[model samples]
Target: MKGLILKDLITLKSYGKSLLLIFALFLFLGLSSGSPLSGAMMVMPISIMAAYVTFSYDKLSNWDCYACTMPMKRSEIVIARYFVTIILSLLFFAASLLSYLFTAVIMQNFSEVYLLIPSYSVLFGLIMILISLILVLNYKFGPDKARIALILIFILPSIFTALITQSNVPMPVISESTIMLFCTIMPILGIAALLLSYLMAAKIYQHKEF
Candidate 1:
């Protein structure tokens, strides 16, 4: 399992320079706009993109077929991918948080930093759920078709949001307790989704003819 994860990390090493550039760009944007959340908002999508690139590399190299020939269990392969995705997500989150803090310091608005914790926690949970769905799609459909599905997954949300904004639907007012409850529940749900996704991917890979 360690070897499998190491291989994926090595494959992703080529992305190092690009990742740094993106971080610097977003950091600058946050500073210029005086909005730390702008930098933080990039975390989920960037992590997802990086994670998907690993899948693309695996497909191009026919890594799965070769992996299956080895003595490792199919479930381990799925787990390794999940681990890599999670590690990438956390790394990006840390970078975004640092950017947020730096921007807050420059703006002399450190008071708002604490306010971001709950929001960021919720965002991280949602990101996990999104990555879970991506993993299942990639495992079941292969990377090529999965890319199309992923595009639709992202586009439909934007279309729905646009419709909602055009309709001018009044947003509901919620109590602080309600918001806290939601933040608490979402991470638990995200964890459940991730576990289920792993099981589904393992089952798919088990019968998959590589």
Candidate 2:
């Protein structure tokens, strides 16, 4: 598992330049907006970016042949992909938080940023859910249709957020306490989703004839 994780991280080396450029752009946007929305926008694009890289391995490289020939079990390979996805998502997530913090500092409203954390936590949970769903859909339906499908899923969320941001209604009873409770419980759910995605990927890949 450790070896597979190391290998996956090493594979991301070539993507660093593109990722860093995106981060630099995100930092500028975050600083300009001085809002959590800037950070959220950055990660929203990156959730798909992470999925693209994680799955593109087999399609682009000779990795499928070598990984299958080795002692690593199919299940282990699936677990490793999910593990790497989680780690990268988390690192991006932390970057988003720091980006928002830097924005607040630049705006001279550092004290106002505490509220951003809860919203960021909820958004992270939702993104994880979407990522797992994307993986499963990609596994079952292939990538092209799945990519189109996820883009359509955004319409409803965009509408809901627009309405909430534009209206007088409260945010669905999600008080700070509820957010805290959710924050406490969400990581467990995220981990469960990660495990389930790994198992589903393993099941699909194990019997898939290469």
Candidate 3:
């Protein structure tokens, strides 16, 4: 499993230039916006993109077929992919946190960091849920179809946001207690979703033919 994860990481290293460019771009946006949260928002998409890049590479190389010939179980392969996703999520989350801190310092708003902790935690949870969905879709449908589905999934939020902005409907006022409850529950739900996704992916991979 470790070897499988290492393989994915080494493969991803070849795309270091592109990733650095993206990082710089987001960092600049964060700095320019002067909002640490804005910079941190880049965490989810980038991490998801990294995960999909691995899937694309695997599909291009027919990696599953080759991997099946090795001694490891299929479940291990699925688990390793999850591990890679989780690892990438953490790495990007940490990077975003650092970016947040840097932006805060530049803006002389370091005190807001404490206030933003809950938001950051919520973002982390959302990232996990998104990654879990990506894993399950990739394992069940292959990367090509999964890409289309995920694109729609990504677009729904924007479409909803646009509609909400144009509508006369009033937004509900959420209390701090409710917000706290949501922030606390989101991570727990995210964890549940990830474990469920793992089970589904393992089952799919077990019966999957290369």
Candidate 4:
């Protein structure tokens, strides 16, 4: 498992420059706008894209074929990919949080920073669900349809967010306890989705001919 993860990190080396540049741009945009959710917006896509990039790299390198010839279990490989996605997503979230904090310091207002906790809950859950969905589709359809799968992954989120944004319904004012409870519940659901995704992917890969 560790070796598989190490291989992904190495594969990501070539993509580092592009990811960094984009991350920097998003960080700048978030800071300039003084919006933590904007910072989170930067984090979510990039984190999901990182997983896609790794899978693309593996396909291009014929790593899957080679991996089957090795001693590792297919389930382990599937789990490793999920682990890599989680690690990269968490790292992106940390980076986004820091950027928000830096902006808060400059503006001398920390209230917005506290709001990030619940906002992050939503963002993180959404990303987990989307990432897992992408991975499962990729496993079922294979790399040949990966581009289409990626598009499908982004479409639902875009439409949902758009509807929420365009709606005339005013935002609700929830008490702190309610917000905290929501934050706790959401991440648990996200984890369940992630685990279920892993199981489904593992089953699919185990039966796949590679």
Per-residue lDDT of candidate 3, residues 116-170 (tens digit): 7798778878878888888898988899989997787679999999999999789
Please name the candidate that would achieve the greatest lDDT relative to the true structure: 1
| Residue 36 lDDT, candidate 1, scale 0-100 | 72
lDDT against the true structure, each candidate: 0.84, 0.71, 0.83, 0.79
Q: Would you list the rank order by lDDT, best first?
A: 1, 3, 4, 2
Instruction: Estimate, for each residue in 1-210, the C-alpha lDDT of model 1 and write its tens digit.
Output: 999989988888866556677678668878777787777677877877776788899989999889999998999999999998888888788788877877777777665666687878788788888889889999999888889867886788899999999999999999999999988888888899899999999999899997
Measured on C-alpha atoms, candidate 1 has an lDDT of 0.84
Instruction: Give Cα distance to truth, residue 16, candidate 3, Å.
Output: 5.1
Off by over 4 Å in 1: none
lDDT of 2 by residue, 77-134 (tens): 7777777777878777767766666666667666555667666666677677777877
**TM-score of the candidate numbered 4?**
0.85
Ranking by TM-score, best first? 1, 3, 4, 2
What are the per-residue Cα lDDT tens digits for candidate 4 across 127-201?
A: 888888888888888766876877767797789888989996688898989878878788778888899999999
How accurate locally is residue 76 in candidate 3, as Cα lDDT from 0 to 100? 92
Stretches of model 2 off by over 4 angstroms after superposition: 159-176
Cα lDDT over the full model 2: 0.71
